[model samples]
Target: MSSAEKDKSPTKEVDTDELYQKTKDEIRPKLEYLRSVDDYCTSEAYEAISLIRETCKSLGRSKEKISKRVVDFMLEKGLAKLIVKILRSLVKRNDKSAYESRAKTHSVAKILQSNVKSREKKKVRIELVKCGIAYPLLQDLGACDPNTEDPRQRIRIITDLFSLRLLTEYDNPSVIPIYRSAKAVDILMKFAQVEYAIIQVRSLMLLATIVNEEESSRIVASGECILTFVEMLQKAIDSKDHHYLFDIKIDEENEKEFFMTGNRLTEGLNNLASNDANKSAIIQYGGVATLTSILRSQTSKGEKQEAIEALWKLSFVESNVEVILAHLNFDTAALEELKKMKSSDDSKLRDASTGLLHQLEMINIHDEPPEEKGSSDDQCHDPPPSYEETMSGMNVMISYNWDHQERAIQIRDKLKQKGFNVWMDVDKMRGNILKAMADGVEKADAILMCFSRKYKGSACCQAEANYAFKLRKPIIPVKVEQDYDADGWVGIVTGMDMYISAYSDAVMEKNWSQLFGELESIEKKD
Candidate 1:
């Protein structure tokens, strides 16, 4: 073999299992000493921590399976808590040596960022949250000089920000009180405005989760927050490179995170739109035009959905509704897309589009001259403006136990694709399940009774089925489980009807065609 070819050849792989088993006993004593010691300032503590840090480095990245075993051992011995305490103590000191010891910050961040299984990482993050890790990380963010030219310092700050993002990703309620106590909203808002893409994205993500109420939303709306999101979204629309909104050279590996910037920005706007004043602010910022632009462009379905939802929320404000109508009139293609979405396969998209169109139409009629009041063939119109008038077509609600949610979702998607409005608890139903189910039943033109042994036994499913029967809604019996015969209450309600089987994907095509035929029959009867 050539020398270069030899260099490219694979080397002997390390047996991480054997290595971990061999060295864990030796590593335990050092960890125990560090965990018991309160002050990491002493020489003995420094020596032991240095050894552990080196050991972590030797374990390689958390992407390797064996490294996690070592991390788990260290965590079991309380090293994770020790590292946080060290960080807390270090944050109070402005000494050079204290700054040097920030290596522990990197170590802990690495441990949390481990590419171990997702569930395991989630569990580890929740456990570390209890260790009071957030406060110290926030302190690090507050202390770091954002504009420093030093690469190490930038990396250190990025590590701190990433750790904070992971902790807040799940939006645990416990973090809110702690964040409120630390005035985290203000801290995060400051970083959200930074020019650095990584820091800004993480900060915006953190802010989106914590800014959950009217008071917080109003607070953000009063600042440049709304405009910031508007500007980012506008940049994405203008450049047509939906992946990178910011003017940064992103590596291939990091491109996915930056690609979500549009979604995150729209989500931030959605959260803030809960407050009425914020809705007005969004309109004034030209957010309506930009969101409409998203619909006009070839953006992802998720981004489009978020944009539509945001516009729908803003539509409630009278002035904002006028602005939306004016913009849509000028952008005829976007208006067409909005109208087409009324028949979108996504239930939420269809619902939002119908509602937004209804608002625009009602406001237009109120503002029109009497001579122009009579509806023209080209102008949009709806039945007399009422709550139910906002929704159209035959709304089908899928009644099934949670055990058969997958099957129900498949049916829901198929019906939606066939131009039927579908309401399933997993998507359309939110808030109180009982109340939502009742509303679902009352509004539904037909109910798909998905049956299985477990589904027949479920109280919630029983309630949904019985309620639909009482409302005299047309029931389409569907067998969600293979070879399952419905008996008891289910059999009585769906007596002797043709059963549409949705037991598996292989049979879905035939099942959907049959179900569509049934829906067609109902439509004709109505």
Candidate 2:
């Protein structure tokens, strides 16, 4: 053939017809034996299953269709129940077959992790779930003994850890809740507490994915896991050479691990700290110092910014601010790092760092001890008018998420047209938002609580609404997002309060008038 002709030749595709015939011939006998035997030898089961696993894995690397067809055939032969049953027995055995057992567990995890068609993967996962695969895999994970002297055992442990982590990364919604039910969360948390950095990182990644608000709140209430997460950050900061916590080499894949681990650790801490009661727990558990260490470490920009954000959220609490200041006194570099980042070329980092500093400054100003009344100059510097006196006649404060800002403004205009005094942050207050929000809520007679998913997610809105609730201001819940029911903290804060629907133009036209009437009723009752 000519060189040009050779170069132009299409790449050879795998012969699906031949591959299918060969794959069935290879696994059908083993599948038949496993299905027929009610009591099978461990070694025999491992041998048969591992061979099928390897054959399918090899095919999957080249073509998903061929591997998927093979998996379908195995499922048709009831491989899911057979594998789970065998896995349960093997994981319970403490003999020499332990390594093989973990290897089998790893095989199933790999199967689930395969890049098959999504529908096929979902089918496989559902079948595994029905067969109770999570219990044995979690059992193996909980029982994993990282034998330092034996490299094979260690490799098996790492394989199991990676496999379990992959299950967490899978998109199937059925997996996590089932895993959670099988006590997978507590087991994963136990795994994270192990001394191995790789184990800890993998476990933490799974926890960050599956932990709900209630679970996180429980973690904070117990005050156990919060410090462990904070210490992971401290480890990263203290390591002279990077990758000390994760122990990964400086490759593209390992670098990603470093980045992801950092993000997940910070994210976990951030989520835990979002709960108001947890704020003091975190501060007491040395979270402030560990977070500050992250700011000073050679972590990724995103990770450092997240640390700043967590700190920013913690700063909302007055007592927590005191703890942060105490930490800042000794670790001056953390404050300097934050100050330097205020001018960062990265917009998000700059804004976050700047916002954190602004919050600290506001806290300091509010917490300052007042001067004595003896001096005339001090008398002349008397405190400014109270919110009630200065912003008199404001009827309601419209607190809404920025995503629904247009809706908020529309509501504000309508109120104003009816000669009702309303307060909404249309100017988009940047750094000094907390104080502005306090002022708005403090001045108004009622707070218009705009309920949406984004509204519930916003830390600023939470702070605003909580402050309003704290001051005993009447909160009028306004439904802004259709089909969204308030839950978690939002649900508790707005508990049993009547919600007025204004989710769409039609709904608003019908129900928006109810808001004005409610405000009038509140005013008259006051």
Candidate 3:
């Protein structure tokens, strides 16, 4: 082959195998040296270099190709780490003043200067109206002379003044300039974005309080503003910060306002309960996933309590009930946690759980209207059964007319001798009259209704009867007087016959034996 022919053959294509080999020989040592440096050590960088080097050596390729690839890989990884560190530091500092000062001194002043010069030439008043400025200050700034040669400098001064006004609003409410401009609110909200989630929550709450109705409407209307507020709440929840959850204080004056405004943001959460519009919002905003995460956290007692309360509210919306129930059913861990919470020692926790349980029960059972099932009056008259009488002890709740307090006591004393826990209104009616009655009725196995004319006249006697009937307990109506007709009573319990005793000294003396016989019969039936 001639020299010209050989040259036209692309110099024999500089054998790729030899080229890769050459490239790897030069870069491999450099990579190893760098990897030995602790500061530059990274598994990914090392792996990339090592793989390139091995491929080149195996293929007998040029070192230049391998070196170039390794360099690119290292640069990409290094740049990413550098960018992340920069962002982290910037986020940590969050210095709004620095940025604001720079903008005012440089950009804003130049624009203001030009506006002032134009105003002076036309002898026109130049007003700067920003949402953050007060009306009075805005009017003053507008009236400034624009004829000055350094109009840009004047503009800078105006921006500084505005910035100062904003800073004042942040520090002291009294220093807020006369301008009721939205500029101040905008600046404050932006500043709050730099603060921690806890601070952001508090600031948003305060802003919701102090901002005028019109201003609040405008701010909320701004999707960005509302989104920022939600983001703060989400971050706090994600952090598993129990302290933040309970730190929310709903004072009397602002409680309604907070809830009303918060409802808008929490609609998505509520939708989880009702599967309504809020559900879409929740899924869109990733709220459901966040809430599930919060529920999964091994939070403090207080946090758990707050979480449950929040969940309950979310579940209140019909659409979200299925979501909540699904979580409860599928998340066995969460369900176990909630079950433990039911037995919490904190009265508030217990009360909250009790209320939730009651709501759940009512919902599950499809609570029927009182009139549909039976009148409240019917419930008022049916007494509850007492605990079963045991050799250890038995409890009997005597529902009788206070007018028959004497007979009720006599019966109670006789039952006490038979090792029965007898709860008569006279002795048991102390703290929380209604609660005491409920306890007695709930704990009793058989309820003894001392039916008499006076029993119908007493509201308390009627209440006891109602509770017993609602409980579907065994009730024995003992007619204590001849004139009292059991058939006329509202809850005239049948199947169990009534025992009548004369109001005489002779019968009163034998009341113990008579009561014992009735008690035995009730036990035998059980």
Candidate 4:
């Protein structure tokens, strides 16, 4: 054999391939036996992971053999179809409870190994193709949930796909289109708005991958995408939620995950802003001020670096320069912070500091800069606004179970045209689902709790209603379905009384007008 050929990794060697096949052949019967059982997240599956690992080790074959066997078993048992069902019902979560559950389930798939080697991951993806698992997996991503399924399922599916996409060349036309058809891009943006720090960060990691392209980046920036990052940066600065991962009762490892995610999202924004149109979108929506705030805040070094990088990227756009200069906290403390960084140990950071100073000098921005109002885009349509401020009348928070999202969105858009600030997940849900929900409920002057026949039992809906009650935010119920009856927990939140009905087309306008009246007249109680 040629020396060059011999230099190839074991993965490339045909002898290893034969060894893997032999190992698989030995385990195939046992795998079949395990697959017959109903679930794989139990003891039998954990045992299977160990068995496959041991068997591959005994044969002197690589771990890819084990991952391949696991994939083979899941496919052989037609588990992919079941996974699709899981994503469908996933939305109907237990949202009504006053206490938020902090439990996280262990990933049965990870038992294939905690962090599959890239080679093994590739092999597993290949074996999945060989076993015909990809088709069903892709099918699940594209299949529309029966509009009545829990909306949280989209969050679940997107989270699930992160690993699958990483395992293969998900960027390929065949696979990517399925995600696109599933509106995966939009799903991710909404995913970002969620409040759970881990999920929020995870969603941003996935979005960073998606927004690598010029067109995709522009699309994301033009929407609620950049605005979402601004919110995250603000939270990171205000709450420092990830800083004390121990102080917070979240997952141990997620502490690092949270910090890393912050950096990843900052980098994602940096990348998205590289495109001229997207940079404009970022600047137009007050992204510049938020990023500069990050630079000035007591955030972690990596996060601050990302903010610096984002500023550096934004500076490339000439139109964005004035806004950046205007919002830069050029007070002595801010300037001193920038100047001190010029002699940093990190070369990248030193360069970023020096460039920022040079730019400041060129612009003659020697004083504390003036505060800039809203994005250039919004100035054309409304009054001066903060980063969180939308075109406003009533700052409305619409809470509904996913089953009735179609109606919820219609109400949201209707309110928007009428100049009310509506916070509905359907339109612009991003970063940290639970946190977003909590923050929305807390900030809104009122909430429009949309319901349908299936809504009475919805944990998500009830949870929002309960949260609003906790905060003393008045909930105005707008029923889109004719048959939904308010009872049990629903009655507790909305009162055992009548609500607005949109049953007939003739009363739609009058019903909405009345809802608006409630929005305008209801005084917010502290």
Please report, in order, the local distance difference test score of every candidate based on alpha carbons. Answer: 0.66, 0.68, 0.44, 0.52
Error of 2 at 224 (Å): 6.0
TM-score of each: 0.53, 0.53, 0.27, 0.41
Say which candidate scores most in lDDT.
Answer: 2
Clashes of each: 0, 0, 58, 17
Which residue pairs collide, candidate 2? none
Name model 1 segments beyond 4 Å from true: 1-33, 36-74, 103-107, 110-114, 139-162, 186-205, 211-223, 236-260, 296-301, 325-526
Candidate 4 to truth, TM: 0.41
What would the per-residue lDDT of candidate 1 be over residues 1-526, giving only the tens digit for each residue? 9999999999997687777776687778877887676776667776777777767666554345666687688678886687778888887675556666665554645555454455556656666778888888888778777665554555566677667766655434355567667777777767676666556656665665555344445445445656666776677666646644332323444322224456656665664554444667778778888888888788776777778777776765567877888899999999999877755555456545655665566322223222232332223322321112223378787888776787788887767666788777763342223445666788888888988755653444655787788789999998876644665456777884568887888877776778888988997899
Kindly give the stretch of ten consecutive residues in candidate 1 with the minimal lDDT sum. 381-390
Considering only N, C-alpha and C atoms within 3 Å, which residue pairs clash in candidate 1? Answer: none
Which scores higher on lDDT, 1 or 2? 2
- Which of the predicted structures, 2 or 4, would earn the higher TM-score when compared with the native? 2
Model 3 regions lying over 4 Å from their true place: 1-201, 207-284, 357-526
- How many pairs in model 4 have backbone atoms within 3 A of each other, for residues 3 or more apart or on separate chains, i.e. clashes? 17
The number of the candidate with the highest TM-score is 1
Q: Write the per-residue lDDT of candidate 4 for residues 1-526, one digit (tens) a residue.
A: 8889987747554565565566557666655654465444445544654465455334323455554554555445543333333323332343322011100111323233234444444444444344433443444434424222343443334435544444334222233334445556665555455545444445555544443233344355435655655666555556645331212322445321214345545665664554444666677777776677666676566776666666765665457667777776453455566666654545456545655554445422223232233322222222222223556545778888675676677787888777777767753332223345666787788888776534543333444576688788888877765544554456556785857776445666668878777776784333
